[model samples]
Target chain A: MKLLEIKNLHASVAGKQILKGINLTINAGEVHAIMGPNGAGKSTLSAVITGHPMYEVSEGEILLNGKDLLSMNPEERAREGVFLSFQYPAEIPGVSMVNFMRTALNEKRKYHNLPQLSATEFLRLMREKKAMLAMGDKFANRAVNEGFSGGEKKKNEIFQMAMLQPVLQILDETDSGLDIDALRIVADGVNKLKSQDNASIVITHYQRLLDYIVPDFVHVLADGKIVETGTKDLALYLEEKGYVAYN
Target chain B: MCEEIVLKANESRDIVIVNEPNVRLRISQEEGSQLRLHIIDWQSADNDVHIEQVASNCVTEIYQVAYLKDNQKVTTHTNVRHLVGGGVSKQVLRFVLSEHAKGDFLGTLYIAKDAQKSCAEQSNRNLLLDDTATMRTRPQLEIYADDVQATHGATTGQLDENALFYMQQRGISRQAAERMLIVAFLSEAIETIRNEEQKEKLLNTIDSIL
Candidate 1:
């Protein structure tokens, strides 16, 4: 079933148009890779989908599981099972990761009319997720993303995605700034978290991450629009020929 | 009214001031006496605080925090005099101002000529949430003695905009994010309170206001 459908979506930041007219549909149990060069509006698409306040959607509609996503606020959209794993996770000093995750999970649970998890239950779940990501015990007590290494930040995002278990996950440049080992660990975490009931959108510049995640579909975003869409072979073709030929 | 209290050796005291104007408190600690004071500067028409350590080997700690808004002006003066040797004193003060509110702090730490081997530190931090708000912080340190460690620092600034945007991106509303940042800013002073009930009550009060 289609989990998200974006049609003729045009977005602008600071009154300057960035995403001209974009159309895409994502279904469950599928991984979609969006590849583009710098200034191709790859990040803008993610920001607009996540309802970042700086971006203004000038036209078109976005439907998440047949609901109007444009009508919901950022938090409401998140509670509705739309998660964006930011390229640069925020560093919140003095706010422990434990506290932040607990609050986020509880808030999402409350939106679904579920009872709050007890402290023991929450901690157990956190430990399990961290173990899956191969993170250390110290991550739970440290400030949220504060003083964390580059790889740790990306892994923490995936870990949060695991805990939240959103229906549609948007991985914005998750492979950037990651070494070979860190890339494998992050890809492994994402692979483990995948299931037939959910899907993901992997935004990246290189085909290396696509080799691991193996997107079922590849879309080339250029000049604020998706200009090409094809199977995994398209990613290899672009990697060999580069984006200039496509433009 | 004037109150003069002496803390005997190895004694500890917890003082709570809710409402008062023009308060002059003279507190002297004997040798080995430890004084932990939490001065809640809330709704004081006018407030003044004076403390001194007259004996050696004594420890003094003072924590003062105030939240003011709506054209209210609060002035807090703290004077710590270390007359003897081998004593330590620490003072931490913070104020959150909003609307047209005004806050002023006068902190004075004096180490006498013969007060050797003494350590004194004072820090005053203020947060101004509104453009019209004003804060004046004066940290005065008079150290006449050699071989003594003394330090004082004061800073006043507005909320961090980047932090606010970061929280907003995480699906937290702007208002909730602001409240969390303000609470975190004030928690520095609130964490020093030894009484659990008092700390919780003050926290709840601050939350309600926000």
Candidate 2:
């Protein structure tokens, strides 16, 4: 089943065009990798999809499960099971991880007409997800991403993806600052969370991450468009030849 | 110039002032005494607090939080003096203004020549929620003893837009996200209340208003 469809989508930031005439379709149980050089509009594509206020969709449309995704706000898009693992996750001081996650989970549940989880139940769920990410108990009490190491911040993003259980997950440069060990742990968490009913878009600049997550299809984005599409071997080929050809 | 409040030797007191249009109080502390004062204002108010540690081994704490809107105004003036050695003082103040409201804060800290081994810290943080709202903050400190440690900081600005978007992306409505940020900003002052029931009540009231 098709999970997301982007048709000739064009987006701009600060009144300057970034994504121009891009088309893509993602289906359930599929992992699509978007590889590109810097300034190729890779991050802009993810930002526009997640309804970031800074990016405006000037033309075309995006559909999630055949529903209009462009009409929703960021919060509404999130409640609809759209998640983006930010390249630079914002550090929010004084907001505890438990409180933040609980609010998010309950809001999604409310959107689905499900009952809210009690405090005990929510804590239990948090513990389960934290253990899945190999995070310690202290992680639950600390403020969200405040003073966290780079590796810890990436792990926190995956941990949130685990908690929210989003259907359309966009991993925007999630492996940017990870060491070898942190990368493996984050990849393992992503692999564990994959299901037949969900899909993922892994946006990265290197092929090292694909060796672990393994994408079904790889597309090379350049100059505000996807200029090339191929199997996983395309990432390996780009790693050897470099994006000099595309640029 | 209200009645002068005096703390005898080894005495401790926790005082809370809420929503008074005009507040004026003078407090004197003797040796080994402690005072915890909390001021909360929801409407327009002018507050003046003067505290003096006359003897050694005195401790003083002051916390204030004010939220105003719709042409409401609040002014807070605090003067704290340490006369002897081996004393500690801390002050935390916060104000949130919206619409056409205005806020002003003046904080003064003085340490006498004999007040060696004294430690003092003061911080004032304000938030302006609208374009028309305004805030002015001035923190003044004077330390006569070279051995004393004193620090003060003041800042006035709008809410963090990045933090707001982060919460919104996590499925929280914008209104709800803003409320959470505001409460977190003001929690530093409210957390200083020693009374559990009073603290909870104040939190609920602030939550409802936001």
Candidate 3:
């Protein structure tokens, strides 16, 4: 039943230690919120799990359904159903959102030994997913995140999540830079995609997002490790009293 | 000096050159004439293009893209002369080089006396896929006429590392990501072609080479 397991993970970036040792396990149909201060290595944890080339994993083990994940490349990790919604999504000029998404979806399908979608089927699926994120058809012709507003970029990230349908979705500070309205719509879209067969990892600093996408488990990460893990009330407790308690 | 050609009033011309052994063109435009020129070089030694607007209210546009690898070297020179007022000229050029390939671009724009209110702009962008690839660019502007608008810029760089990682996180290999970024870089000029079939063919050729 366990979807992802991080055991004694230690990682470093640019020769500086970030993640000392992180151990966490997630089952199917569960939402885990990782709350930490600015330098607590929350993003580093996500990057290491996703096999970012910048990070040097000095020690530890990562497993997706008991398969060794650290041995796989970044693209291989993605094909294994791991997704990271980047906090600062890159802007690719002259590459349309439609072409990018189709290539990604088809690559995933090819990895799973499935046939590629026909043009009609691909467009139909794109329309269905775009409607979920309230994205307009104009985005299909425009470049990927080239001229999009902050809110639109965040929405586009979620739109991509819908198109890829990864089993283990990691939302890395998705609520940052989002207005209240954008936050609601993004959280709503994420909520609609939750199923019993998939899990999520929500990384954020504020508890405002937890009120919308309530997490089943909350973990306090400080000094490169999880200091505490508790139920939903822990989020409220941390909201009332900030991570200063853990500090 | 290449043989000179002229376009009469109210005329339009579209010229395309691809991997020619030698390219030397000089065109003179009469009143109310239009010229659209494209120069795509996969491998070449030298290319020279000059467009002169002799009368008023003429238009000129030039687009170029060059892809080179190994020890190939290419030099391109463009000269646009505005003799009368009420004319417009624009140029966009791109170069992609890998390995030990070298590229050079010299763009010259001149607005003669009494050629007031003429507008001209030039942009040159190059992509170096390897450390040894070299690009030399010189954009010269000589505007004797007062009350004219002209601008020119040039830049050389590598691919975006952040964008590459973003794509790899979405299941695209690094090779594929590089291809996408390179196509995105050069496609800006390719998009301006008026013919759809030619545009598609050139796009496919670029993609296949990449």
Candidate 4:
């Protein structure tokens, strides 16, 4: 099934254009890697898809499962199974991880017309997801990302993804600050969560992450457009010959 | 009328005053006495709280939280005097104003010349939820004793926009996210209430109003 379709999408921030006439399509049961340099609008694509308030969609339309996504609010987009693992996850002090995850999960469930999980059921689900992510028991009690290390923050983001079970997950620069061990753990979690009914968009600058999460198609984004598309070998080739050619 | 109260030597007390309008109180602590005072207001109110540690080995704590909306206004004035050595006093005050609401806080901490080795701290934080809302905070500290430890700080800010957007992206509505953040902001003061039942009731009341 067609999970996501972006046609001629154009976006800007503060009246400055970032994503200029970009097009992409993703089907269920596939992993797509978007590789680019520092200023190639890679993060903007994720922002535009997740409906970040800072980025304004000036033109074009985004569709998820044949429905219009641009008309929805950020929360509505998230409840509709669109999740973006932020490159810099916000740290919210005094808001416990348990309360936050429960609220998000219950909100998603309410949107799907399902019953809200009870406290016990919610705690059980949290434990299950944390175990799946190889996270410790103390993680659920602390404030969301407060006083956490860089690696722990990234791990917590994946733990949230495991709990929310978003259909169209966008990993925006998930490997930016992670060490080799943290990267391996995060990649393993993503691989374990992959299934036939969900799709992922891995946005990264280095080819190191692509080796672990193995994208089905690799695309080079340059100056707000996907200039090249090829198989996984394209990532290796780009690793050798930098983005100098795309510029 | 101002009410007079005293904590006897070696006595301990936890006092919680919620939404009482035009509250005025004068409290004193004796040797080895402990006092925890919580002042929480959800509506427009004016409160005056004065506390003095008159003897050595006394402990005094004060926490105040107020949430006002519409055209409501709240004013709090606190004076904490450490008159003797070996005394400790701490105060935390917070307010959230919305719409055209207004908040004012004047906190004074004083340590007498002979009150050496006494410690006193006061903090006042406020949040203005709307452009038209106003907050005026004045934290005064006067320490005549050279050996005393005294600190005072005041700050006013709005909610964290980044935190709001992060929660929204996790399937929580903007309104819900806002409520969560507001509650979290005020919880710092509310958590200091030693009485769990009273704390729970106050939380429920604030939740319903918010």
Worst 10 residues of 3 chain A by lDDT: A238-247
What do the candidate models score in CA lDDT, each in turn?
0.86, 0.93, 0.92, 0.92
What are the per-model numbers of colliding residue pairs?
Answer: 0, 0, 0, 0
Q: Ten consecutive residues with minimal summed lDDT in candidate 4 chain B?
A: B1-10
Docking class of 3: high
List candidate 3 segments past 4 Å from native.
B1-3
Candidate 1: docking tier: acceptable
DockQ, prediction 1? 0.37
Write candidate 2's Cα lDDT for A127-182 as tens digits: 89899999988988898999999999999999999999999999999999999999
Q: Candidate 3 on A113-197: residue-level lDDT in tens?
A: 9999998999999899899988888998889999899999999989988888888999999999999999999999999989998
Model 1, B1-210: lDDT tens digits are 368899988788877665465667888889889888776655644666677778899898988778888887788888889999899999988898998888889898999999999999999999999899899999988999999998889999987766665565455566877787788777787878888998899889888887
Q: Candidate 1 chain B: minimum summed lDDT over ten consecutive residues — where?
A: B164-173
TM-score of chain B of each: 0.95, 0.98, 0.97, 0.97
Residues B52-71, candidate 2, lDDT per residue (tens digit)?
A: 99999999999999999999
TM-score of chain B of 2: 0.98
Interface RMSD values, listed in order for every candidate:
2.3, 0.8, 0.7, 0.5
For model 1, report the TM-score of its A chain.
0.98
Of the true interface contacts, what fraction does each candidate have? Answer: 0.23, 0.63, 0.79, 0.90
